[model samples]
Target: MKTPEAGDAIAAAPRRGPLHGLVVLDITRVVAGPYCSMILADLGARVIKIEHPDDPDYVRGFPPFVGEGDDRFSAFFAQYNRHKEGITLNLKHEAGRELLKQLVARADVLVENFRPGTMERFGVGYDTLRAVNPKLVYAAISGFGQTGPNALRPGFDNSGQATGGLWSMNGYPDRTPVRVGTIIGDVSATLFAAIGVLAAVREAERTGQGQMVDVSQQDAVLALTENAVVKYTVDGEIAGPLGNDHPFVRPYGQFPCRDGHVFFGGYNDKLWALSCRKFGTPDLVSDPEIDTMAKRFDPEVYARRVKPVVENWFRERSKAELEAMAGDDIPLCAVKNIREVVEDPHIAAREMIVDVDYPQGRIGMFGTPIKLSRTQAQASGRAPNVGQHNAEVYADLLGIDAESLQRLKSSGVV
Candidate 1:
């Protein structure tokens, strides 16, 4: 049986997404960089993922491997790497470096998440690549930005969270800081990187000149500091963790339900009155000390009156019951766990959960959340195998033959 080729598989598939004609040279691994490229690939860009011939991506060895022996695959790797062609290239070698330059010449975008100078050391940095492909959108995601004093400092999601002030704003006020459940910093940095790449790609199309997109995970997290930074800068206030509560909003935050927790809160008088009406507590709405935003949000007033009343109301009802009553009247949500989130009716109706077929079987993955009226994106296929498109990409794009491809593989140049 003939083996399937990577670029051929995507190229043969019908092109329906908005980014149909774009080509992305994906030199990223792990979360942030791969995620940015994966978004491009999902939007119908032909993303060629370049890796080292010997080591490949470290995430390929991550746990929850399926199948047996050498064929085992990592679920973690598959999560962010779907819908891209994988190719191995030993960039340390001059032959491999030239091969990448050739690919770069034809690519529209290139994304990498290595430390600041790693790509330069490999001789494939933005400066070198832009010399070859003047219109290529080059994006880099790192812990800090490219030119900061700490740009060379090793950083990860945890580092971004801690240093960017997100850690200080989470958890209860009395407890030590806690990392968020997921790597929000890494994920947000990827999203910002994608946005940067798309914007640069647009400008490049107009001017025929590509630019660099430098995204720092720490900077991304700092950008999302919300009211924390501003409050300090403006009001001389230092915000601390409020335990599931909104810092400046009363009756807003997590509360107890009969079965599980509910996130129900009111920020303004109108919503607070709506909440009071829903809970059959109209008298509280007229209470002089807690009628206004300033009064209601005051810590002492909230602890003495507002929180107790709202918490008592929610505690008596099941999450479903509360949800039914609060429908559109107030902003309330049942704090859902992973299983609940996946199985949610709203999530399913919105097509946020989708089935993706793999070699072993079908598994459900989070679907594209960017809904558009004109051109829709899709999760085209499963992740590719290691160097899965050597013959096809090299032959079709670089004009190398099957025999030469094999020779390159034997010499570890590809």
Candidate 2:
């Protein structure tokens, strides 16, 4: 692909701040890729999420569809696709494939999670796209990688956890391997995708050439559990799961209090002494055997010595009192369910949940975590209806007449 000439690099459409004039075309559905696009969208990029016309986003038909049959909207879709425009493209058709090629010429970033060979099979691979646009960043999220023995394998989040090391590190030693409560591995891949996209974008800005951002679910999972990986490699000892307890650290997990449980990690002497003082059991300070890491690992001695004292103290104190007493000397947090967390003062103050207007009055938007002060990121748009922008985007961008647009719609092409 030839480099863009100064004349070919026309003045870009301005946006509010950073990511101004950026264009993103997202072809992936469900969690990971959508999460990456959502972050980019929140950062002021114009993200166009392409869905198939005949069989829309699988999320449209995913169970928990609200209101009516095939409503074309779902909670899962709404959460992942906030702050983006959506249009349907029947990629199975030649005309539709050509349209994608055209869009690639103008787009800045293209994201997809189709099985390994699907994009190349569609004639819209990077080598093909770069001919039209040299600075087009193509991102792929796959199970293993774009090329590998397991590259084409389906990257189900739970299955990836099992294949990755997370499952082994999740449960108690003797129990069945447990998967995490939510889509953790998927989020992990999304994080990797986000980092890759931004880095590629930065490189393209410097060199005026785009590159491939390949993210593997397997790689992402292993990347996340770094400590466990290092432990295994260093000692040749498989890191075993210890449930709510830390394997190497003492009293570094959840403990039951009067109202509920509280998680605390006493990582050092100062914190450990503070915990002991708070519980009015300062005797823990003098025991040189209990004070050090090696002594704490003596399971029988440590368990019998610490458990009775810690449990009795926790059993007498309420969660609030324990939280107040523990202070910042140790990391302590009361276990909170979703309902409690939604109502939490810090969460509310941080605007983690905002009232977003929907057809059914106002629904909460549990928004993205990052808060940009100078240029605030928001879901300026909502999750779109299928082909909602058919007239605006197709007719305007594709330069198709209204009659032709309607004709294509009638022919199920839009």
Candidate 3:
């Protein structure tokens, strides 16, 4: 309950989960398969997930955990279901698809996204779970792939960012296509379905077996701009959006300040000449068209020369005094919302918000961006419930018992 600071603990720790003793099997769902099994349960994979108990997770009922006071389950389904282990099953019965093929014969991995041929019409795809785990891996994720021609349509992440042109280069050049305010194509197709299940779990730990990866969310938003596909293949120009500015960088972006907005990037020419000497205008940083960011798009010729002297010196400064008058000489920030980014003080000294508890109590929980230094990773619980590991992953990974897990949950199959 402390650590967070080295730049918000490298964006809120969690790196060590290098799939500690593997064993996934999520069977995936919303948010690109629960964000690729919560990034392989934050690198320590021991996932299990499943879910169904009379159909739950449509992001457990979506919303910042449905509240007008007591709805439950969501904070967007506990932000991609923390470190796994929930349960419940029906898999349209056959003893719950033979209890997910005997938990894929003791799984090594087996995510999913269900759509493109809905797991080969539920025989549990990947060639029937590689005949019950020939060293598994499996992954899938979808929306626009998993077998061509719009693989049975139905996507989202706003239709895979407007069919993958990333909402036609996202907002502002005469407005319209925006969408990037989160769910960036379902967290970039859940980081390419956790990099295709850690490259098929490092080739099933060196060819003991396993394969079938897939992934797609419109091919991860067209591989997130191959530099706008090499500038629309060497200039037939089509890039749009310019809302906050910066593709190359000149006094970077968003500048209000005095009690609001304060971004800033200032790419070069000595941070746009230290933002024209802290806005007193040391001669508009030698103005070759607003000193080149390929010309700050001549926004009304640099807003009649330097946006009214940096918007009247940020109307007398305060986004922490123009972020302490641009310290590292540039690269600053401040445009926050969502209650100033969940009470940010560097997002609470970088734990990016923690405290979990669940059934909707302590709350918070939104960390992990990636960091390592001796294998960090976190969010060890919360987001379980529905069948919540029905008697510990059904008598330890299907060795069954407890009256065959209560006659497979009174024969509903779980």
Candidate 3, residue 240: CA error in Å?
Answer: 19
For each candidate, what is the lDDT? 0.85, 0.77, 0.73
Q: Which ten residues in a row have the lowest lDDT in candidate 3?
A: 3-12
Top TM-score hit: 1
lDDT (Cα, tens digit) per residue for candidate 1, span 360-402: 6566778888887878888646888889987777765677878
> Which pairs of residues have clashing backbones in candidate 1?
252-265
Each prediction's RMSD to truth: 3.5, 3.1, 17.9
Error of 1 at 111 (Å): 0.3
In the predicted model 3, the residue pairs found to clash are 14-377, 15-377, 16-375, 17-43, 19-43
TM-score of each: 0.95, 0.92, 0.38
> Could you say which candidate leads in lDDT?
1
Ranking by lDDT: 1, 2, 3
RMSD of 1: 3.5
Per residue, candidate 2 scores C-alpha lDDT tens digits across 193-266 of 99999999999989999999999888888887757877878887787678998767776788899899988777
Model 1, position 198: C-alpha lDDT score: 96
Give the CA lDDT, 0 to 100, for residue 222 in model 2: 85
